[model samples]
Every structure is written in structure tokens, then in C-alpha cells.
Target chain A: MNDEKTYALKSKRIKWFENPLISEDKVYWKPKRAIWFWLAVLSFAAAFGVNVFIAPLQETQILPYRIFLASAVFLLLSLHAAALRNPFLRAKLYHYCQFIFALGIFLSVWDLLTDKTSVLPVPYFPSAASVLQVMVLDHALILKSALYSLRLFFAGFLTGIVLGVSSGILIGWARQWDYWLSPIIKVSGIIPPVVWIPLALSILPGSFSTGVFLIFAASWFPVASMTANGISSTPKKYFEAAQTFGAQKKYLLFKVAVPHAMPNIFMGILTAAAFSFTTLIVSEMIGAKAGLGFYINWAKAWGAYSKMYAAIVIIALEFSVILLIIGIFRRRVLRWQKGIVK
Target chain B: MTEVLIDIKNVNRIYRDDAGHKIYALRNVNLQILRGEIISFIGPSGCGKTTLLRLLAGLDKPQSGSLSIEGKIIDKPHFERGFIFQQPALFPWNTVEENISAPLKARKIYAENKHKAARYISMMGLAGFEKSYPHELSGGMAQRAAIARALLSEPKVLLLDEPLGALDAFKRSELQNNLIEIWQKTKTTMALVTHDVDEAVYLSSRIAVMTSRPGKISKIINVELGQNRDRNDDGFIALRKEILKELRLASISPQPEYNI
Candidate 1:
């Protein structure tokens, strides 16, 4: 069956574009078959080269850097092609990338575990056992740092939403308030939230409070700005309709404006969360005594490069988890907004 | 003669530009609309047809005019007057049911009245699609939903501003009959603004032909045909010809040019 065509407006002309860029319906399989054949051949060559040939050279402890480089190039090429044209292909490629990335991570860990090349390998062949011993010993510190950072992020993020939404409604509904407050809001939003760390520490109770304050500051601007813009742009007809019905101002705000402005408010919150993650790290480095950022700094100071790498990896994983949850919520809240062209 | 429901007299509206140049959108306008009369306002674009409708709906104010409804001066929009615009301005985020019930909900129309008010959902032929959102509906369906929403409030006077002007020919014909049927059933006063002379002739009891920009009432023709008028009849044809000639005359006649 032919794919359904969707119409898009470009200037005065409306043109139909086909969706589902790839499907099982297509007759051409030449490119897919060719790519699969090369993948099979390359896997065999790498397997034979590492296990049969280079197993003996492990007294010198091989790094498998060539395997890493070759696999990375193949994966990147396939992923870029899949994502550029086809949604189904892009989903499949993303899953494959995740699997490949996981496998690469496992191989890197195995290499480090079995090899005898120390990070500080100048005149010393430090064994892999020593590197493993340090990680096992610092496990508790890593867990504590991760939890501390997450706690700060949630505290500041929630507070930012409360302040942003209330202030946004005021600015949006009242012209006098908008005129008076807009310049201040603009000037203050421009100053990076992280710059307030030292000031927060002096005014707040503790180090964690400073990090939380940073999170709040980082998230507040986008939500407030978006809420204000959304409310102001509500169709005048709806407002007038409400007036004809004798709807009170309170009813107008709660019943009409809030729900209408929700999408933009959610967008603001999403951006705030992203900015909070980045600022949380910076704030931890400046003020907090414990966090993922502090652990990385501590590892770096003591020259434990492997531990530093692992901590950074954990931070990335946490951010990914938060992003996934936010994405799911976004889909649910915006379900009604589907099928509308911007 | 019918009961006078709306009365406007000596209405003058002056608009000032950024450089303080004066423009008269309406001048010395007078009109009286009866309880069950269907009135049509026909004029060129920007002849203040829309402005007059807005004023009737209490959405705008006239600089020097007296407007009364049932002999009471109207200063604010009462729920007694309902409006439908050319564009179906249904809220995009709400379903058809929610949009139609909006004014009802605002008035706190009891849960009991909801079932009665909801009868218009099917009366307007949107029964199965009540749950559908505005974006999902066709242009005709969307406009129908808007009309349903306006009627749900049960306004005594309906001010329709080119309500079917945006629809395709087929949809427009279907809706015009439906509008006539609704008008005959409810006997509500309606003032419709449209540029389509044929629509004005078909729907209106009396067609008030408006002159070009800064419009004045040029002629008000009383259509003498029966309620269910025949389109192919000679009498109907003669009335249509006379209107066309008058419209052409208004367009070509060389006369003294005022700012109007």
C-alpha cells in the first residue's frame, strides 16, 4: 500500500509529503542486504584478530583501540543515514546504537580489568588489580555524591515552578504589571543562575541550600517567560466570549488561561530541568561539599583518572533517566495537541 | 410591524491615526431592528460592517450613539446577544462538547439543564462528534460547532458576521438552509453582515444595502416572497435583478466625493 501523504504550507503553495519514510512495503532491499553482509565480515575479522592472533601479545597488554575506532565509524555512518530520512529506521538505529554502546562500555571495562597498563605508567607496569581495588574501595563515596546531587536538583526545580507560574499570570493578565516587571525580569534572567552561588551561600543555611538555590534560579526564567507570553497571546475572542457570559477574572485565569498556557509552561519546565542539571554541577563545584561534581573533582585531585571517568559516566546516566521521564510526561500532557501544524 | 428589540440612533464613530488624521468609520447612522426580522448588512470591505456588528454585540463602543435593547440602554454585553464570526473561533484545545458548553458552564447552567442544552449538539447535527476537537473537524463542521456554541446560550438576538462566508459553496448552501430553519423555529432577531448579494437575498426578510467605505444605508428592500421562497420564480428573479442594478449604480455613479 502507498504511504499516506501529509500536506504542508510553504508560502502560497501546499505540497503533499509522504510519511513512514521506510517500511516493509518497499521492494528495494539491496542497501540493507549489502550493509548486513559487511557487518558480518568485519565482526569475523575483528574476532579472529583479537582472540587468535593478538592473544599472545597480551603479555604487553593490548588496548583494542583499533577495534573501538572501526566500530565507532560504522555505527555513526549507519545511525546518521537512518535518522536523516526514516522514523522507523531511526528508532531501530537508536536501539542498535544503545546496544553497541553498552557492548563497547563492557569491553572497555574488561580491557581495563585484564590489562597491566597504569594511567601513570612511567617506568612502572602497574597491574589492572590496583585500578580495580581503588574503585571498589570508593564505592560508598560515589553513591553518597550521586544522591546528594539528585536531592538538590529536585528541591530547586519544584520551587522554581511555583514562583514562575504565579508571577507569569500576573505579568500576562495585567498590562501595568507587565510594563513595570518585564525589564527587571529580562535583566535578571540574563545573569547566569550559577553566578548567585556565593551570594546564596552567605544568605542560606548550608552548602546544599546553595546548590538548590542555583537549581531554582536556573529553571525559573524560561517557565515565567513562556507562561507570560502564552497568557498574553490567548485569543481575544475567547476572552470576549467569557466576558459575555459574565465570567469573573478568577474564572478566566483558572479556567481559560491556565489550561491554554499549559503547553508553554511544560516546555519552560523541560528547559529549566536541563539548565538545572548543568547548573547543579557548577553549583556543587563552587559550594557543595558532596555531589557527583565533588566526587569528580576529588578523584581528579588524587589522580584517580578511572574513578573520575566512572563518576562522569554515572552523571550522564542520571541525566538520561530524568530526560526519559520528562519526555513521557510531555507526550501524555500534549496528546490533544497532536495533528496540529505550527 | 414587529416589536422593536434593538434601537440605534445618531451613531458617530471617529478613528484617529498615529499622525492625528481623522477618519470616520461610521457617521450619523440610525437603525431599528425588530424582534423576529432577519436583517442583512451588505457593503464593500472595510465599510465598518464588522464594527457595527461588534457594537451590537457590545464588543466596541460608539463615540456618540445611543443603543438600546428592548428600550434599555446597552452599555455592556449581556448573555441576551450571541455572536458568530466568519472564522469559527472555537478553542483549539477543547473538544466540540467543551466548546459548545463553554458559555453554559460559565453561567453555571445546572447539571439538569446540561441535558437540555446538549440537545443542540444533535440539533446542529454534531451528535457522534461531540468528543472530537476543533482541529479534527472539517471547516464546515467547525463553523457548525461554533454556531451550536452560540445557540446553546439561547441568546435573544444573534449577530452573525459573515458566518458562512468562509465555507465552500456546497457547505454554504447546506448551512444557509439550516440557518433559515433555525430562524423560523426560534424567531430570534438576527443581523448578518455579508458581501454575497445572493446570500443576502436568500436569507433576509429585508436587505439593507450599504454604500462603500464610511457606509450609509442606501436602500432597504422588503422581500415580498413567501417564507419558503422559490428560487426559480420570476418575482424572485426580478428582485435579484433590481438589487444587482442598484449595486452597479452605487459602484459607477460619479458624485461629489466626501471623506466617506
Candidate 2:
């Protein structure tokens, strides 16, 4: 009846080429409550049942109703929100419902083998229940270690990024700086930071500083190289265009070179973050008194395999959260890259 | 009597190819651009039309001779000479307003010329797209923004290297009119390099036809179609035919040795 409605109908008609049979809207309708959410709830309920009803063949640590209560609360909340399309986590829950179901299935199978039956060997492969219990029981030490690791990682990673980017930009822009500095960087970059443990520990005054040193080394090389590459690889056209408008060296560097090299710099930071984490764990394992890596080593020495597994899980979660933050920050900064990147 | 805006004399630009062979990008090129005139260098590819444009913009240096504007030697690029490339070359990060106003900021004269950016944006019909990024614009729109950017600087001469080559026919005609309007308003010297004979005829006061392989100007034709050129007019069609013939002549090389 209206112009917009006619245009919409015409556009929809154009979609006939994509699928001749199902170009109509009614064919693509989805239900109010997703089937996957209920399936996840059912799967989690089954795991809860296995944990409660069946007794273990051999004695293993099982926190009375922690898992049961948590699952019950989670299921109740999920069930309550299933029908509604409220803004908070509705889409996320629906999307990851299948993954949640698979996790429950995995936990159920793991429990049956290790705790409920004596088929698998003990200590080496602890039941999921024991691992979860260790996380709760050793919460104090775990929390302290996680805090220490965070401080060290942040100190090392931030320092490395700042220095790496500054020097990289210098080297990329000025030929003299590249000639003078890149050789040393290239040499240091070739050697892995893990190998510098003995040397760095000897040179640095303390273990914490040495840990910082190694992590800084791990992050520096990739950031520098990627930043330099990004800066240097900026098309000559950009420079020429800017120069015609009376842009001097400083303006050109800040405006044209820096903006163009941003995607590459972000690439470098991502790589550096990953590498720094690797070095963080290694440095902690070797000498540090408190960290996730240290916790892992400490648990292994005491034959507390469950604590070691718990520490590893915490490390993954911590690292993932840090990466998620970086990802969000980068997406906001590079919002202009939407159509260009694609 | 119009004064000479740019005096280009016997300029040569030589570039070395991969095997260390000397290649002539341009050779012995001479042209004098007059003030407030639209002049075009029209030829086939590799005729060094772009190379000549770059030389005028001071983006590239000549191996011999020199280029100067108003008796001042053009050694480096300056705001006095604005250049437009085939690609818009708008910064991907900056919005339309930012792109157009970037020159003012770059020159550290933003306070004085800040108002001109808004005027130019409206002039180019990019008023609503001030916040939109260059990637968000169509090819023609981006190029228009680029034109506005160059014009905001108020250059003495505007060198265009196939600025409308990438646009579709409709967009090209639309932009051609936009260019004509801008030219009429500013009266800036426009030196365009294009292969499109119709575009050359429709826009420029004079067309310099060039030959390839060590490029040189073969002929310069005065349009004489007067103002508001109708492409279908008898005189306009005849002039277009005359220029096309010159271009054909420029493309063919005379080799007496091959004559039977």
C-alpha cells in the first residue's frame, strides 16, 4: 500500500533466486522456547542423578551437595527464562545450550569411570568431583596464586607492549633507527624467552623481577616485529596523498602511518599476549613462589593431582577473560574497520 | 590575457626496471598550464599521463628540466598544488568530515579554515555523511569528499590523474557535473589525465593528446564548444571526432623501415 512496503516486497521477491521454495516468511519461523535449552537442563539433571544415587566403588572426596545445588539453581534459572526473550544472556544461553549439554554428558561419563567404578587408575585420573572439590578446599592458596600471577602478567605485558610499540614505530619509520636497533632486536627475537631463564635470573636482583624479565622478553619480539611490519607496509599512496596537502614528517607519521598500521599492531598485541602467558607459566614453574604455574608444580610434588587440574582450569579461565577484554577493546577502537576488513 | 599558472619545461622522469634496465616513464615533456583553465592530458595507458600529473604535483622529481608555479620552483608537494588520484585515497579511519578537514589539521591551520570543511561537505552533497567513514561511501561519494578535501586547501592548481576513471557511467556523469560546478565556482586550474575522450571534451578548456613509449604531448586541442557543452551538438560531435582522430594518430608509430 505504501512505498516502503512495496520496496520491501520487491526486495523479498529478489530473494526468490536464493531459494525458490522457501522465500516466504512463515517457513522460517522459530519456536518461542528453544528445544536445546530443555535438552541441556535434562542432561545436567541426569549428571546430578548419577552423582547422588550411585555410590563410589572406592572412597573419593565428593562435596555433599555443592554440584547438585549449583546445577539445580542453574537449571531452575534457565527453565524460568526459556520462554522469555529478555535481554540478559538469553541468546547466549540458547546458543551455548548444546555445549552445556555436551559438558554435562562428558562429566557424567568421567564420573562413572573414575568415582563410581574402579576401572580406571587413581591419582593420575582423578574424578571430576575430586577436582571440583580441590578447587573449593584449596580456595585460599589458589586465589593468592592467581592474584600474584595476574600482577606479574600485567606488569610484564604492559611494559612489553609500551616499549615494543614505541621502538617498533621508530624502527619502521626512520631508516637510521632501523639500522641501529633492529639487529639487536632480531638477535633477541630469535632466542626463545624460556631459554633466557638462567641468564635473566642471574642478572636480575629477585625472582619476581626475573619472572617479569622473562615475560617482557616473551611479549616484546612479536609486538615489535608486527608493529614495524604494519607501519612500514603502509602504502606509499597514503604518504603521497598527505604530502600534497602540506603534511610534514610528524603529521604524516601520526596521521597516516599510525592509523594504517593499527590492524597490524592489534595483531602483534594478540600474539604478544598469548606468548607472554606461555612465558608467565614457565617462569612461575621454574622459580616463582606463588602463581598458577607454581600451584601446578606444588600439587604435582605433593601428589595432589586434583589440585593441579584445578589450577590448570583456573589459568585457562583467567587467560580467556583477559583475552575477552582485549577483544572488546580492540573491536571498539577498530569500529571503523567494519566494511574494510570484511 | 591569462597568466601561466605552471610552467613545465623539458621534464624527464626515468625509472629503472627489475633487471637494472633504464625505462623512460616520461621524456622531454613540456606544457604551460594557464590560470583558471581546465586542461586535460588524454592518452592510452602507459602514455605517462599520470607520471606527468605526479610531476606537476611535485610527488615525483624530474631527471632533467624543472616545473615551477608563479616563478617559484616546485621541489616538494605543497598545498598550492592539489592532486587527485584514480583511487579516492581517503583515510579509512577518518569520517567524511574528518577526511575533508584533515588538511587543515595537518597544516596546523584548523582554527582559521574549520568552517570551510562544513561548506565543502554541503557543496559536495556529503552533508549528512559527515560522520560516515570513507568505507561507508560509494566510489563517487568518496572521490567527491577527496575533491572537497583538496579544494578546502584552495590550491593554485588541481592535478587530477584519472579521478573519475573508476566510476560507473551514471556516477561518472553526475561527478562530471559536480566537477564542472566546482571548477566554475573556484576557477582553480584543473589539469586532468584521462583516456576518456568524451570526458576530456566535456570538461577541459584544452586537451593535450599524448603518445606512449617515452611519453610526449602530440597535440593540444581547444574545445571552442563554448559554455554548457551539449555532447550531442554538431560542433561538439565534430570536435570529439577530431580529438579521437588525434588520439589514434598518437597511438600509431611511423616506421619508414617497414614500408613496402
Candidate 3:
């Protein structure tokens, strides 16, 4: 009995930090040693070594300093990982270390190709160090263009989502409204909003307004279409039940229909967000004097390939961050669907 | 004669099927519900039992006829006439307590009657699950929550459309007792639709047998058994058998055609 009790207690012990390969019950993928620790150490060594041993073809401000700072940061992060008791954190740190090591190798190769060999042509493919240097020098210009793009993108996206959702609710709830509006939406929604750029530039007072209009037109149709489908497909029984509770037309439309269509509305908004970015870029490329798209164009005209690459990198990072924020919001709002979905 | 709480006169509801053929969901159906009485409409599928209930709830209008509560025409839904659908129909976004308080909130009387929401939650035996959402609750619990929601408004008449049909036998019997307890305490008039003959005989004071294909009521049987009725008792079984026989007959008999 004592032996059985001991076995039961041992089995019941909580293993908060799960090591998949080391666990007694089952074995899966896990390394014998801390993979992240070694990767982090190797990355720090490589970056510091490259900065000290290799000479750049073109000197740039802050290149060596940035590499030193990055190596120190990685060393500190690896030390922090070593002290963590949680396996999940350790696993995540390991993946991040692997990414950094891969990035360091790629950068080293690119630096060698541009500086020491003629494998990559000059004037077109600048060294990574030069790109970083250009980014540091043109920080103010990049910030200004990013701000301009954000302003136009947000203004148009907000207007489009608000109008799309409202009109969708109206169309979904009332038959007469659907009859009059659906046809108009179908015809107008199909034409790409950017196609009207020439006409818009001619009619609008400035490029700013034209850019905002293009984004709004690009984002509005998907949001409206998805919202309408969501509302129309809401179970009729819910409406009937609400009606029997003496709900008015407004109450049924707003309370019963809108909440039911939230998931679909969120999906529409996500689609609209993606579309708005594409439209914003195209609109900026057409005539905008200040924006990321315009900055790229300006850099290309001046044959400043390093600045162009830096701007492209900034845009990619900003777009990914926006998408991540939207994804988090979607998860929070639709928490009820967690267990129901896979 | 007890005071007539709901009066239905010569009601008919017609619909066009998917093939564009005219179908009579209800044909000249008429029934009177007394104040503080339990009435059950029992029939096969597509027999207008639900149609008549919807008309009483004022969810749909009947052509060439009318229904009234307290001598007032019911052209639209009123809080006095509550409805519980076949499915729980609880809002997926709302917790159990919130769903129960919906009717009061809808009528804009939630502030004054807020305390009553807790009482109804306990009354339905859903005390600990007030915070649970509809998807988390079992079918029986969700149905109970729906009942609490409908009753919180203090409706004079509660119309139930197969509210417990989806529950298992054990849960169905448990909810039947809950229903009896509720009716006894509140003395609220109830109209239930069910395919179960035993359920009809167990809870209702009178059972209305309906025929399909231009649905119409064939007979009304008054259950003489009093309160605290035992399901195992000989008289209860007899009433169940009689109602089942009547339903079987109602389904087999030829329906009369109406000239267009």
C-alpha cells in the first residue's frame, strides 16, 4: 500500500516545464542540449568577428557599432534564456536563436559577395552595411513618409469599414433596401478603385484626397459584401424568437443581426486591411509627393539602391505589425468560437 | 366558464411550397385558452400545431381571421405573450443571467426589475451557471435558461414550441417537473406544442389533436387528473393511451379540400 501511494504521488507531480524528449510518458522532438544557447553564442561570435576582421568596400557610419550592439543584445538574451525554468520560453528562445544565426550567415555571405567579389553587380545590389547606413542617415525622411501613408490609410479604412458595416446591416435586414442597394453594389463593387486614378487626379483638388478616395473604394466592397452575407445568413429562428419578445425593427436589426454577423464583419475588415495597403501603395506611386511608395520612386530615380531597399524593408515590417495587431483583436472579440472551431 | 385569456377565430395561414404549389399550414383553426390553464397542441409534423402557436404569439398573421388577448387584437408581438422556440434560441454572446434578463432589457424595464432576474435564475435551478454562455450549457440547461428568460417578463401567456423536444428522456422528465412547479407557483397561462403524447397528457389540462394537409383541430380532450399526478398511475397511462389513439386517427383521416 505504501509503495502504491508513493507511485500515485509521483505520477501526480506537476511538470510545468515540459521537455518532450525527457518526459516519461511520451518522447517527441527535443534536443539533448539547449539549442538556443549555442545558436545565440554562435550568432554573437559571427557578428563580432565579421565586424573586426572584414574591411568594407564602402565605409558607412554606424555599421560596426550596430553589429557590436546587436551581438551584445543576443548575448544578454541567451543568458536570460539560460536562467528560465519554463520549457515553453526556452523552446521559443531556441527558435529565435536559430533565426538570428541564419540571418547572420546570410548577411555575411551578402557582405562578402558585394565587397570581396564581382559575383553581385555594383550600383544595383549594395552591401547590407550600406543599406543599414542609409537607413540610419535617412531616418527622418522615412518617418515622415510612413506617417503620411498611415494618415491616408487609416482615414480611408475607417470610413470604408463604418459605411460598409452600416449599409450591410440595412441591406441585410430590409428586403426593399436590399433590392435597391444590392444591384448598385454589384455593379460598382466590381470595378477596381485604382483604375479611376486618372479621372480622380483630374477631378480632385490634390493627390492626398485622391489617395484616400482610392483606398476607401478598394476596401469598401469586400467589407460590405461579407457583412451583408453574414447578416442575411443569420438563423431566421433568432429573429422570430426576438420578435415574439416584442422587439422592434431597430432592436432586431441592431441587437439580433449585428452581433450574429460579428465574425463575418471581422473577416471582412481583415480583407479590407490587406486591400487598403495595396491600394495605398499604388495610389502613392501614381501622384503622391510624400509616402513610402513615393520615397521608393524618388530613391530609384536618384539611383540610391540602398535607400530603396531600406524603405522596402520598413514597409514590410510595418505591414506585418499591423496584421499582427488585427489578428490579436480578432481573437479577443471572437473568443466564444474558440472551442467550437478546431 | 373561466375568463377567456386568448381567443382565436377562423384563422388560416397559407404558404407557397418550393415548387410554387399552395400549401395550407393552418386552415380555419379556432381555439380559446382560459386564464391560468395549461393547453397542449399535439400532432404529427407539418400539422399546423406550431403555426397556431405562432399566430397566438403574433409572429405571423392569419388571413381572414383574428386572434386577441384580453379582447385586444394581436397584430404584433407584445411582451404579455412570451414565446419559447423548439431550439433554446439563447443568444450565443450572452451569459445565462444576461439571456434571462433580455426581455426586461428589451422592454427597457431592466433597471426596476433587475433583482427579479436573480430570482428567475434560481427558480430555474441555474444558480451556479449564471455566468456560463449558451454554447457551454447542455441542451436541458439551455432550455431552462430560455424558460427563465421568457418568464422574467411576467407574460400573461407563455407559448412553448417543443421547448424540451431535443432533451434526453431523463432531462425531459426533470424539466417537465420544473415546468409544473413554475406553472403552479405563477399561475401563468401556457400553450405547449409537442409530438410526445405522454408529455401532452402529463402537463396539460386539455390536449388539442390536430390533422395535417390543411391542418385543423379534430378534438379537444380534457384531462381530469389533478395536481401531483403520477406518471406510473393507471389513470395517467389511460389518458396517454387515449391521446396517442386520437393522434394516430387524426393523422390517418383524409383532410377536406377548400375551393380556391
Predicted model with the maximum TM-score: 3
Q: How much is the lDDT of residue A325 in candidate 2?
A: 92
Alpha-carbon runs more than 4 Å astray in model 2:
A1-34, A56-76, A79-83, A86-92, B16-24, B254-260
Candidate 1, residue B169: the lDDT equals: 96
- Model 1 misses residue A88 by how many Å? 8.6
Colliding residue pairs in candidate 3: none
lDDT of 3 by residue, B83-154 (tens): 999899998977798888888877788899999999999999999998888999899999999899889878
DockQ, all models = 0.48, 0.80, 0.64
Q: Give me the runs in candidate 1 sitting further than 4 Å from their true place.
A: A1-141, B253-260
Model 2's A-chain: what TM-score?
A: 0.85
Tens-digit lDDT track for model 3 on A71-140? 6666657555664654445545554666666766776677668754536888899877778788788999
Q: TM-score of chain B only, all predictions? A: 0.93, 0.95, 0.95
TM-score of 3: 0.90
Look at candidate 2 and tell me the lDDT of residue B119: 98
Model 1 - which docking category? acceptable
RMSD of 1: 7.3
Model 1 chain A: weakest 10-residue lDDT segment is A8-17
The digit string of per-residue lDDT tens for model 1 on B48-157 reads 77778888888889899878898888777767888888888787778899888887777787475778556888988899998888999998999988888888778878
